[model samples]
Target: MIKIAIADDNSFLIKTAQEKLSFFDLAVKLIAVDGKDLIDKLEINHNIDLILMDIEMPEMNGIEATNFIKNKYPHIKILMLTVFDNDENIFNAIKAGADGYLLKEINPKDLHQGILETLNGGAAMHPSIAFKTLKLLRNPQDFENRECQEEIKLSTREIEVLEQLSKGLNYNTIADNLILSPSTVRKHIENIYAKLQVHNKLEAVQKAKSNNLI
Candidate 1:
């Protein structure tokens, strides 16, 4: 039986998921109200087969938690279940090692199929999100394949900063949001611009967007 755990803020969601999975012949081992709870459970028992994680939660959101789990337990599979359809959340979750993403509004049958696909080592994305992910992965601009793009070299943190900036956030806001010192935010921005060969924020953001760097 697949041993699954769910981490979500809504009790209704937890109950609903439990009910839906009750007939699947799988074991629902744990339910978490937040990322921290999920982490604690994993620390005590690392036998989880799959995790359904919500994007937004109290203390350490799912993206961070998923990254941590993937690093610590590379064999486990994570499927993101969230209400958000935003590109930023989708990209970040994918970057953080999610194996699949299914919107909360997905029908129970589709959700079940998604779980099976994820377990079989295939990515399952909500139809709405799959389009964006494909665009980023397949059709990155400059009309060049991303792997062949020799001009772009950005560190992971710098890419994070650039992603935040592309969302129209300023350095101070990015600093506060990422819990980085303001000076550190500035330094990342400088590095991003230098890597992208852009002189100003507008140009940097435009180039990044055009090239799908963020």
Candidate 2:
């Protein structure tokens, strides 16, 4: 039997997915409340073949969880089963290594077909999402910029600090230029690094410049 795990924050949605899959000859191995809950349960029982992941969840989001699961359990297939079909969500889910993307409103027969297609090394994407994916592939730079804008949102102070840092200014010099304390400058730098997902000053400046953040 094809063992499956469903991860959705809403209990009603989880039940709905369960009912949809009930028509198939698959087994519902577990139903998790959210991304973090799914990871925890998988630690104990990860014998499932696939996971129906929701995008927005408490503790950890689906994209983050999918990245982690793909890294740790590369054998398991992840199908993003979410209501959100936005460009950012779709691009991020694909980048996180989801095997398929299906809308929550999909009928049982199509849902079952999607699951099987995903297991058989074929992507099961909604037609609209498939069109977006093709556009993304055609113009990756545009999608990359869009994805960067969505993920990295910096405050004005953070931008100012990054600008100073880009000019080879130390924390104290940045504080002097911005008329803020050295500690405050340091805090702003920390926030910038976190938002930009960078380690040091050089990487932060490079990322900020590439994304047009500063």
Candidate 3:
């Protein structure tokens, strides 16, 4: 089995990811609540093959963790599984030596395939993320521009998800109201984050309202 470590603060997300991973020959060897927790656990057991890293975590963020890990354990591959897909985050993750970057919305089969591909020395990226990666490469200087010129577009469903998130509703609750699966709600939220260039619900909500998208 491919030994993997998951670094996410949300237990529900962790459980959901675990359930999807169960379909493959992957073993979740360790679970860390955040970047700091992941670092602490690696001190005890550093024999894992790959890490499913979340970007936004308390104590230490994923970029910091990835930098430290790649520096200390260069042999171990770090694949970023995150909700944020903004230009700066993608640029920073690549700069920090992440082996691959994938969004949280990816399906189980694709995620498993990505893990296998990353283990085999290939970079794994969600298709949309792959396009962004190419754009980042072509215009590295664009990283300096924090403000995106493109219009902020939130789909009808995404706006609904954002509106629900603004009310401090959890994923399952939002899923129920929207008549979407929890996973689908999660995907919509991820899209919202990427579009708004925000990491969390509060930021997403604030940006959406400021842009009059909600």
Candidate 4:
């Protein structure tokens, strides 16, 4: 049986992946919740044949894991199984040395076939993903616009928090002004940072301003 590794933050998704591979001659040898976890596990047991990697997670993401694994364990195959089918994610995963790109919605048979094809050195991809890849290649200019054109959804409260953040207001002051507790304000800011995909106050504010979210 081929040894398989699954890297995803959600336990449900991990279990689903295992169920999909249940009937095949593949064994789920290891499971990791994030990219850092996957790397640490691989350090102990590098015998995994293929890894089903998810793109978004808490500590580290699949693209980063794929890059690191490709550098350290060139023989191991990585198939990105994610829900994100955006142009940026697709190209980034490809550049990170992912052997295949399949959405999480794939059925059992297709997922198995994708895995087998990837193990055989084939670049398996979802049909929609393949079409998008061709379109990206044909119109390279679309890559930049596709990312920016997508609307960044934020709650009304999140936007208010962002606006307060942009004014250089401290968490306490913002909370007082908005009639919220300090810890609630802090949580709102955390959500804002996550939604904007920014780390610091400056970055979050700047991204919100750039995207016109604030």
Best by TM-score: 2
lDDT of each: 0.86, 0.92, 0.90, 0.91
Q: Considering every candidate listed, which one attains the maximal lDDT?
A: 2
For model 1, how does the per-residue alpha-carbon lDDT over 103-211 read when each residue is reduced to its tens digit? 8887778888899999999999998889878876665442344443456888888888988998889879999999999999999998887888889888998888777
For model 2, the run of ten residues with the poorest summed lDDT: 143-152
Off by over 4 Å in 2: 148-214
Q: Can you give the TM-score per candidate against the true fold? A: 0.66, 0.72, 0.68, 0.68
Q: Per-prediction count of colliding residue pairs?
A: 0, 0, 0, 0
Q: Model 3: which residue pairs collide?
A: none
Tens digits of lDDT, candidate 2, 9-44 = 899999999999999899999988888899999999
Q: Which stretches of candidate 1 lie over 4 Å from their true place?
A: 139-214
lDDT of 3: 0.90
TM-score of 4: 0.68
Error of 1 at 94 (Å): 0.6
> How well is each residue in 1-214 modelled by candidate 3, as lDDT tens digits?
8999999999999998899899999999999998899999999999999999999999999999999999988988999999999877888899999999998888999999999999999999988878999998998855544334246767898988889998999999999998999999999898889988889888988877766677
Instruction: List runs of model 3 lying over 4 Å from the truth.
Output: 145-214
**How well does model 4 score by local distance difference test?**
0.91
Q: Which stretches of candidate 4 lie over 4 Å from their true place?
A: 145-214
